[model samples]
Structures are given as structure tokens and as C-alpha cells.
Target: MRKALTLIGTGLAAALALTACGGSDSTPSADATLDPANPTTITVGATPVPQGRILEFVDENLAKDAGIDLDIKEFTDYQTPNIALSDGSLDANYFQHLAFFDQQVADKGYDFEHGEGIHIEPYAGFSSKHQSVDDIPEGATVAVTNDPGNQPRALKMLEAEGLLAGIEDDSAALTLTDEQNPKGLKFEENQPEILVQLIDDPKVDLAIINGNFILDAGLNTDDAVIVESAENNPYANFLAWKAGDDNPAIAKLEELLHSPDVKKFIEETWPNGDVFPAF
Candidate 1:
């Protein structure tokens, strides 16, 4: 009877152990249905010009193909998109060039990196009062961007027009001293975005405008008296993300962005040659 009681106790213990195991198994864990390979949504930040519109197109088409949803957050200012991306509020951002990205990373000490090149929107010289590039008189006040990156870009544009000649061809560090203006052209340096407002001023003869700012100002690229060539500009746009996110989604995005469909879309949408595909 002692042996039988011992055996019965053992059996009861085993049954209880099985019951506990079953209970633990039946209660679903939080990650039970989660699949990292197939995320449901991807949120990206961008500006409201062509970049945002292009991303919206990519989201609608590419997300559907990949069986994922894309949510795009549009920001007006340059700083907020990177902030959102770093804080995990956005999966990626689509509106900055590699140079600007490098500047941001260096300046803010952020751990972000850029992915594949997207598109190139050439900076151009526009004038509301002057009908042609040659019409500007001597001592005309030309407006340029005061920001470091854009300032050089504006100077380069002036150099390209034969208005300035002292800068070396390959010098990325070229400055205002490059200007060898024969016509005694006066330059006014201000923020690029604000240069558009100067068009209403009679003193400001012409302004060198960045592509994004030009689009933001509701001005047409064809209306620009002088435009940059799209053939070999190195400052094309790119996708930016955290430094270590070697996720498959980023690869997928790059593949789609470089595909022929996007190229065709850009060509057709920007027939005036304002925005050109980098891929």
C-alpha cells in the first residue's frame, strides 16, 4: 500500500506539471504573430514639393506590390524631418542631398546615413522683372544664397554663365572670390528661400534659386531665365536612415526607386526637365 501511494503521488505531480505547461502554452505571447520580415506599415518623412509627391506615388505603387502600407509625413522645414527620423517617429526621409546629409550628421552628431541616389533637381537663376539673361544691366544687384552649401552652388551658377571666372573647375571649396564679373555686377547674399521675395523688389535684378525653393515658391522651371544642366551634377537627392538599419525594407525601397517605372514617371511628370532621375 505504501508503494502504491507513492506511485499515485508521482502520477498526480506529472499530471499537474502537464496542466501547467498546457496553460503556459495556451496563453499567447506578444510576439507570437509578429514577423519582422513582413512589416505592415512604413512611415517616411518628406517635404511637400516633388519629393513628397514622388514618395506618395512610390508608396501607392510599391507598397501595394510589397503588401505593405506606406505613410508619408510632410514637413516644411529642413530640420524636422531628420529629427523625426532619429526619434523613430519616421522610418526614413527622402528630401536631402548627400552633402546636406553629411553636414547634418556632422553638425548635430546624429547617427544617420544616406542610401541610394534618388533624383536631381537643378538649381537655376530666375528673374521676374528681366525677361532674358542678357537683359540685366551693369551694376545690377544679383541675389544669391547665404547658406554655406547653397552659397557655393549659387556662385557656381554665376560662374557657369561666364559672369564669374576665378574659381577652379573642380574646386568644391570655391567662394565668392571666384566672381570675376566684367560688368561690375553687385551681389546680395540672403537665404535662398527668401530670395524669391526679393523678386518684388526693383533693386534685386535676378536671384539664383534652388530647385526645391523654386518649386515651393510656385514658380515654373521653364520660366527661369537660366537653368542648370542635368547631365552631371553630383548633388542628387537620396534616402536617409539610421546608421545601422541594414534592413531588407531599405534594400527593397532602393530597388524600387532605381527601377524603370520611377524613371519613366519622373520623365513624364517633369517634362520641362526641372527634375531628372539619378538612376
Candidate 2:
């Protein structure tokens, strides 16, 4: 009886050992098709306005379909996104246009490149107290963006409305001096984001606001007194990354950006044709 009991115990121990060995061996090998070290994690930096919202949509719908994991970082200021991307803290960014990106590269010497063209948010002139551009009296105080990239944009829009004249050479790099204004309109240069606030001030007859800041200020594009024409505007937004990092993730992102899903979203979300899709 003692011998039989000892034999039974030994057999049980052997079976347990086999079970342990099988468990270890059966653990799924890191998907051989996928790079074991390179996970699907990607970090994108964006502004809290439409750019951020667009990325959020991609993270929710597109990333999963592509078998990628997207992490979004929101930035309130314009400069931080490029800085983060340059430092490798972010995989990509989506808040700036080509002109702005070029300016950053030229001024700050950051090595960044653009991915797919996303959308163009047309800048517009809005007035809270006045209903139409015609209502703006002579010598009216008009607020414009003080930034280098957007100041010319504002002036071009103003010139388009016949309030100003001679802007034939308007470009992203063009300044106020490049154009000749005969309307005698008082030009007040301030931050584009603050243009909305200045509208409430009695001195400001009109304010030229960027699309992002316009949305941030809770105003609709259709409500603008005058809007920039998208017909030939070259300052469309883009997805930017470090110069030579063209990885599979960027390719997938570009594909998704140009897909019909994003096109539909841009159409539905920005009805009055304010957001023009580049893809």
C-alpha cells in the first residue's frame, strides 16, 4: 500500500510539471508578422479647435480600423506643437499650414516635413455691431491679425471686399506694406484670437478672424460679413512630422485622411463650405 501511494504521488507531480511546461510554451509569440519592439502607439499633437477634433475622429474611427493606437495631445498655443514634434515627443502634428510650417523651419531651424493636405479653413471678416460690409463707415476701425502669416491673409480678404485696393501681390509672406490701401480704413493689428473680443469694443468696426479662432469664439462661418475665397488659397492645413520619418503609420494616416470617411466628415461638419478638403 505504501509503495502504491508513493507511485501515485510521483505520477501527479510529473503531470503538473508537464502542464507548467505546456503553459509556458503555448503563450502566443509576439505576433511574428508585427515588429515586436515597435508597438502601434503613436502620439499626435493638435490644437483644441477643429484640428484636435478632427484627430479625435481619426483616433476613434480610423486608427482601430488600421490596427494602430493613436494618442492625442492638445495644445492651446501655436508654437508648442512644432516644438514637441521636433523634440520627438510627438509623432506628428496637425494644426499648421504650409506657410506657417515653412516659417517655423526658417525661423527656428526645426527639421519637419508635411504629410497629406488636410483642409482649408477660410479666414473671414466679421462684425458684431454691423450687419454687412457696406455698413462699415469711412474711417471705421478694422482689426486685423498681427501675426506675419495671417496679416497678409486679412489684408487680402479686405481688398477682396473693395474696402481696400491694390493687393495683386498677396502671398503668405506679403506684409501690409506690399499693398496700397486707399479706403483710409484704420488698421488695428492685434492677435487673431483676440479679434473677436475687440469686436465688442466701440472702436472696432470690423474684425478679421481666422477660422479656428472664429469657431473658438462661438461664431459660425456663414455669419461672417465677408470670407476668404477657397478657390486658390494655398494656405491649407497639413499633417507635419520630422523630416525623414515617413513610416508606415504616416502612410496609413494619409490614406485615412484622403478616404471618403474623412471627406464626408468634413462636408457634414463644415457645411457652408468653410472647410475645403485638399484630398
What lDDT does each candidate get? 0.67, 0.69
Report the C-alpha lDDT of model 1 over 185-263, residue by residue, as the tens digit. Answer: 7888875557878876878888888788788888887888778877678778887766666555655665667778888
Candidate 1 local accuracy as lDDT? Answer: 0.67
The CA lDDT at 114 in model 2 is 74
Best by TM-score: 2
Per-model root-mean-square deviation over C-alphas: 18.7, 18.3
- After superposition, the stretches of candidate 2 with alpha carbons farther than 4 Å from their true spots are 1-39, 168-179
How many steric overlaps are in each model, in order? Answer: 0, 0
Q: In lDDT terms, which candidate is top? A: 2
lDDT for residue 30 in candidate 1, whole number 0-100: 23
Where does candidate 1 stray beyond 4 Å?
A: 1-39, 168-175, 178-184
Candidate 2 lDDT for residue 99: 63
Relative to the true structure, candidate 2 has a C-alpha RMSD (angstroms) of 18.3
